[model samples]
Target chain A: MHIPDGFLNIPVSAGAAALSIGAVSLAVKKVQKTIEDRLVPLMGVLAAFIFAAQMFNFPVAGGTSGHLLGGMLAVVVVGPWAAMIVLTCVLIVQCLLFQDGGLLALGANVLNMAVIGVLCGWVAKKATNFLSRTAAIFIGSWISVVAAAAAAAAEMAISDTAPFATVLVAMVSVHAIIGTGEGVITILVVSFLKRVKPEIVEDGACRAL
Target chain B: MKNRKFIVFSLLACAAVVVFAAVFASSYPDGLEQVASKMGFENKMSGINLMGAPMPDYGLALFGAGPFSTLVAGLSGLAAVFLATTASGWAIKRLRRSGNG
Candidate 1:
């Protein structure tokens, strides 16, 4: 969920932006040391794919629509570090080119969807290690979407933009349904990549995925 | 995976999805937008967007507000992101190589 401008006050937006910048800088450093040269092109392609996929929104309920966030998919395909970069790239393009999300809120959007979302997905997958890979992917993707939404809601609430309980409830309920789409898509994509391009999987920074 | 083949496949997939989305995406407001509308904060959206995007709201002015314009917008966005990311990857590679050297 892309937060538009004026949704949160300046303080929250600036705080999120600062956090996003710090996280992205860390990810950039980590990726420089760990990212395989062969996976570079794949990272770019995955970013483009995520950008394209985000364009298509399916109806969730009551006229609300949700699209694939692709955070977990990116993390699984690449790694948390590179995935964050990919997502930041996607978010930047979306803001600068399409005006889909607010430029003022770009930092908050990136923080929620890229850094927090990917990290939550990675954590979820690791936590569910006993589960099958497919199941873990599903759960991880779902958790990532819901967690991002929750984080956004908390930011809004903290900003006094909306009532905390109401915003949290609305966001979580709608995102839970939206998360199912993310989970399914993630599983399919990971499975397809694993089948057709096993080497990419083997060579990825996140070997577990 | 073969690098060339992977590149081709990825581009093709992105192109296909861009075309498909241009044709099939729902015009309804997304989750956040919907929530904003419901919570009566929809009017609160106001700010100086840093970029005066050539195609604001993913519609091309030259093509008029129609499916064709949307298709053009989607394809152009797809191309832009693809090139941007590719260039970014190239830069990162160069940086890594220089650091190693």
Candidate 2:
């Protein structure tokens, strides 16, 4: 979810922004080393897809809506480092052009979705190594969404934006359902790619990492 | 060039989704927005944004508040992000090449 301006206090926002800058810089370096030249267009297309998919909000409970976060999907298609770059670009564009996310809050939003979400997916996949790739993708994508929501809720709670328990429960509960949607979509897309172009799914560079 | 077709197909798929989303996305408040409203912190949101976006809320005022305007906005956004990311990837590749050289 995109956090708007004035949601978190200025200090928290700035702190997150600082951390985000460091993380993104590191990601750029890692991507440079690990991303295959041939995958560049694929990464770009995936970023665009993530941006477009974010526009469609499927209904959840109580008139609320949710959309695809695509952090883990990026990680699955590309490596974690490239996925970070893709997500960072998407978040920045959403903030600057669409005004979907607040500029000041861009740091927190990127940290939540790009860094934490992708990392959670990476960890989930690793933890579920014994399972099928499709299952791993599904679980990883689901965890990515829910974890990002949890991070956002924690930020809000720390900023005194809302009660910690209430925000955590509300954000997690709604996002858990949304994450299932993410899981299914990720599985389908990965499966399709696996069927159509298995070579692109090899991810040799990422595998080495 | 082995993956050229796959790349083209993926980009086209992304474009199609963008158009589809512009035409058919729900108009309800998202999870965070809904939660913020229920928790009584929705008023914390103000018109005070750091940057004045040309297309606020992903709609072009010039075209009025309709699906066409949203479509225009989504397409533009999709194109902008695609170009930005592609350029970033190119830059990174160049940097890597130079480092190797």
Candidate 3:
């Protein structure tokens, strides 16, 4: 869920931006511990994979397409700190080069997509791991994307972009379906990595924070 | 020392994936745009005129009806990754030296 420009007010966006800066700072530091020998290259490949995955957008509803957000993917594959850096990089590229998002609102978008998305996904995975792998995947994927969407909606609502209820309903409803796709994709990809490259999954490569 | 290989490997892999991503990126509106279209809120969204641009879609100005635009978008994303990661790395290094990290 890439948030375009004008969705958030200056104050809310700025506040979120500040918080994002702090979170990213923390992430960078945390990643330093595990970002070396095995994790860095894996993180790079994972970033590329996430970037590539984002390109394959499947149609959702109302003529819109949803792709893998990869917040959960990054967290499960790498770790939260590295995921933060990876996602921030991805969002920045989308905004600056592709012109997919607004420059002014990059911070807010990164906060929602990078920081909140990864953490929520990680928490959900941790919470649901006691269940079946499918359940864990579903819960992780669903919660992560929803959290990002809700954060985006909350930013919009706080910024007065749209009515809070309208934004919430629209953002959350569509993303719920999108989350299913995300969950499925994440689970499948993770499973694949586990099978083909067990080291990436087991070693926890690129873990910063 | 041990982590250096991982960092280098990840960076190179990201570069390779970016190439493929650019070549095959779906030409579909994402979540926000989709919501706007379906909910009829697209008109409410305003556009900006950065660099005297005409067509709003990224493909218009950069590539203009060709794969080059997509390629450039993907490469541009790589550029962003370089800049963002470099900056983040520097920021962390500085913070650590300052005894804050």
Candidate 4:
């Protein structure tokens, strides 16, 4: 979910902004140092796909809808550093072009969806390394959305915009459903990639599928 | 899908979604908005009208709220995102290379 402006207090916003900036700079460095030349277009593809995918929000449950967050998918394809940059690009484009999100809250969105979401989801996927490629990516994508929502709820609570317990439960529970949508789309896209470009998909075979 | 074919196929997929979003994207509130509305914090939004943005909410002011408007707007966004990502990646790579030399 794209957090609007005024959802975060000045301190929380500023702190998140600082962290996002620092992390993005580090991402640039890490990506540049280790990024394969072939991966550049792939990054562009991911960023564009995310930006477009976010536009198509599908209904989830109880009058709520969700879209693919794409962070986990990015990580699965391009690794965290490049995925971070890719996500930051999509978030910024949404902010400045689509106004789907707010400028003041850009930092929090990046921090939540790009940094925390990707990294934590990466951990979860790595933890489930024993699983098939399909399963791991789906689980990871699901976790990314939940983790991002949790971070957003935490920021709102810290800003006193919403009650901690109620908002946290609401955000987490609803996002847990939304996470399923994220997982499904990530699987669909990754599976498509695996079929078309086997080299790019790393483990093109899924043990279960 | 690598290089030209990859970029081309990706853009086509993005364009297809752009049309899908313009035509039939869900209008329901997302989880955050649903929660905020339920919890009485929905009005906490600053409602900043970004006058500078070319497309707001993925619709063009010129074409108004119809599907065609959304179509043009979504296409514009797709092009913008693709260009921006590629340009930024190239620029960052150049910057990193310059630091080494």
Q: Which candidate, 2 or 4, has the higher DockQ? A: 4
Q: Where is model 3 more than 4 Å wrong at Cα?
A: A203-209, B1-28, B38-40, B49-62, B75-101
**Candidate 1 Cα lDDT to native:** 0.85
- lDDT assessment of candidate 3: 0.71
For candidate 3, the docking band is acceptable
On residues B53-98, what C-alpha lDDT tens digit does candidate 4 reach at each position? 6788778888888889988988888788888888888888788778
For candidate 4, what's the RMSD?
3.1
Tens digits of per-residue lDDT for model 4, A1-209: 99988789989989999999999988888777765556777778888889889888899879888888998888877888788999999888888987877888999999999999999888888888688777888888889999999999999999999889989999999999999899999989888987887666674211111
Residues A1-209, candidate 2: write the lDDT tens digits: 99998789888898889988999889888887765667678778889989989988888777878899998788877888899999999999999987888888999999999999999998998788578777888899999999999999998988889999999998999899889999988878777877887755654545442
In DockQ terms, which candidate is top?
A: 4
The C-alpha RMSD of each candidate to the native structure, in angstroms, is 2.0, 1.9, 3.9, 3.1
- Docking quality of model 4: it rates as medium
TM-score of each: 0.94, 0.95, 0.82, 0.95
- lDDT for each residue of candidate 1 in A43-131, tens digit (9 for 90 to 100): 87898899889988888789988999999888787888888999999898889988877887899999999999999998998888587
Q: Distance (Å) between predicted and true CA of A146, model 1?
A: 0.7
Q: Worst ten-residue run, lDDT, model 1 chain A?
A: A200-209
RMSD of 2: 1.9
Model 4 stretches astray by more than 4 angstroms: A203-209
**Candidate 3 lDDT by residue in tens digits, A27-136:** 88787544444444455556656765676677776667788989988887777778898888877666665555666677888899899988998888888888876687
